[model samples]
Target: MYNLVRFLQKHHFFILFVFLEVLALSMLSRSHHYQRASINHRTNNLAASIYHLQSHISDYFSLRYQNTILQKQNAELLHKLALAHLPEPQPDSILKERLVDYIPARVINNTVNLRNNYIIINKGYRDGVARDMGLISADGVAGIIIGVSEHYATAMSLLHQHSVLSIRFLKNDQIANLHWRGGNYRQAEVVDIPSHVIPQQGDSLVTSGHSFVFPEGIMVGTVDEVMESEKGNLNSARVRFSTDFGKLRYVYVVKNVYQNELDGLAKIKTNE
Candidate 1:
């Protein structure tokens, strides 16, 4: 009690000044219409700012959950897409089973500036991801899984020198091979194009689906420049890749249901 009294006595004048200031403000606001309106407006604005900050904080915290949901939804949608299924033998025949299944994965490590770049994803053999499975980004084709462990997988990015994809021109169905050379990661080269097929700038390309690694019609890129072989027998073009390797964050691993059977048949043919 003695300490409390001494503390109060020491700060009594300051406390009284604060109390008087508050009292004066209350009286002025209550008596004058302009003061009351101004105070209310300021209070409302402060409250609004607090609420806005709270909302943004909530959204930032929930972003990862939202992204996971979106990835699952996209995988489901990809499974249902007709391009992921084998074509029906008859025009009116019932649709065949889906040829491709997509498993959502997050890229944990990536590179874009190397001659032989590789990508490491969070999914692995435990998640049904395996060697030779195709990898694709939201925008387009990304790479192919080359190695897998129980909990992680590594892929050769499409930007690698050894990475090659069988691609087709969307406009004319011209098949070509896409490969990346050192330098710009945004671009690759398409070769083995037949001379008869003339490629123009901005012409779109997609997966050929012959290897069964990726589904047909998945976007690859667009022609940025047309080039002719020195021998003039084959044409080539520079392609502006659809998937920006530097920005790769999430990708889908493609699983072909008939891959084993197809491999068996291919092996038999090779023996013959």
Candidate 2:
């Protein structure tokens, strides 16, 4: 109590001055329109700044939600595109059968330099991803799912030595098999384009839809160069891949709904 009294005595004048200054300012603000307006203006500005900061924080946290929604929307659009790209002579009922569905997934692991490069994605059989399901990027054809676990899957990249994808000339519809020869990630060779139908440089190649894997017209790449085959009957052309394997981040696994039926028919025909 004694220390408190001494401390008050030492700063009593300063305390009194501060108290009076506050009281005077309060009275001035109440009595003068300009002072009141100035105070209100400052308060409003502070509130606005606080609200803006809160808004930015909210938006930042919602980015993941927005991205997920966008992925779903893109999947729906790609599914429709795949069905529409199906070859003609089909009834509307068959077309509506939804031969293909798209499941969006992120690439958790990938490689481009290896002789047999593979991609790992954050999806599996439980997520509707299965072996032989076709994979594609936003830009073009990517790979095919070769192995699947409950929550993860492996894709054989186009750069793999054993990778084979059926592709067709966009202009003439001439079909050929695309294979990787190793060494280059951007380039693959089309095995059997007839020598007479020369594929000019920059000619686009797309999926032939015969594989029952990738839907027809999904871009593979453009012809970078054409070379004579040692067999002399066919010409092989180097295709520059549309999808950059090194930069693959997201992909869609395509499920061909009618593939089983088609495969069963083929098996029966073979037996006959």
Candidate 3:
């Protein structure tokens, strides 16, 4: 207290000068039109800058909420799209209802730099997520569920060496198997496309609906390059995966309604 008093006494003259200067400015601003206008403009600018800073901070924190909302919206759109693309009812056949259902999930854990990459989602049997369920992102097919807990599930990512998905050429409907080479996260190899199929660069491919994991016509990727096998009977393609694994935040797990019936028949055939 004593030091503060002495310091103030020593600078009293300078302090008084500053105080009078501020008082004069205040009076001038109130009395003169131009000074008042300038002061108002400065005040308005300061308020606007503070508001902008507040808004920016709010948006930064709300990003996760916004992403979750987008994921749910995408799940709804995917459900509708799957139903719309169902094959037209045959002339004498009854159309099946509810062929597919989508469960929205957030990716809680993921890795791309592994020999067999896996994705862990915040959904499990409790959320109707199960093994063999297909996972997809907003852009394309993401993975297939391989393990499930009560409240979480693990999926085999498209980047996994053992991950294989049956895909078909969008142009010619030629079927092939997609497998990853385990180095580049963005590229996969398409095998079993016969040489006679003639795939070009940028040819689009989609799920074939053979395994019932994914709906037919879900995009896989585009052909980046093609090479003829040494045997000259088959062609392989380097597919640029549509789903960016590094940026995956949310995914949809697709459950096929008729999967049980299909699995029963397959088990019987295997036993026989």
lDDT of 2 by residue, 154-247 (tens): 7777887667788999999998999989887888888688988888999999999998989889989999999977767999898999887766
The TM-score that candidate 1 achieves is 0.67
User: Could you tell which candidate, 1 or 3, scores higher by lDDT?
Assistant: 3
List the candidate numbers ranked by TM-score, top first. Answer: 3, 1, 2
lDDT of 1: 0.79
Question: Of the candidates numbered 1 and 2, which has the greater lDDT value?
Answer: 1
- Give the higher-lDDT candidate: 2 or 3: 3
**Residue 200 CA error for candidate 3 (Å)?**
1.0
lDDT of each: 0.79, 0.79, 0.80
lDDT of 1 by residue, 56-83 (tens): 4555654685587568757878888856
Candidate 2 error regions (>4 Å): 1-91, 229-232
Model 3 spans with C-alpha error above 4 angstroms: 1-93
List candidate 1 stretches off by more than 4 Å. Answer: 1-94, 229-231
Instruction: Record all residue pairs in model 1 with backbone atoms less than 3 Å apart, i.e. clashing.
Output: none
Give the per-residue Cα lDDT of candidate 1 at 242.
87
Clashing pairs in 3: none
Per-candidate Cα RMSD to the true structure, in Å, reads 22.1, 23.7, 21.5
Cα lDDT for residue 146, model 2? 71
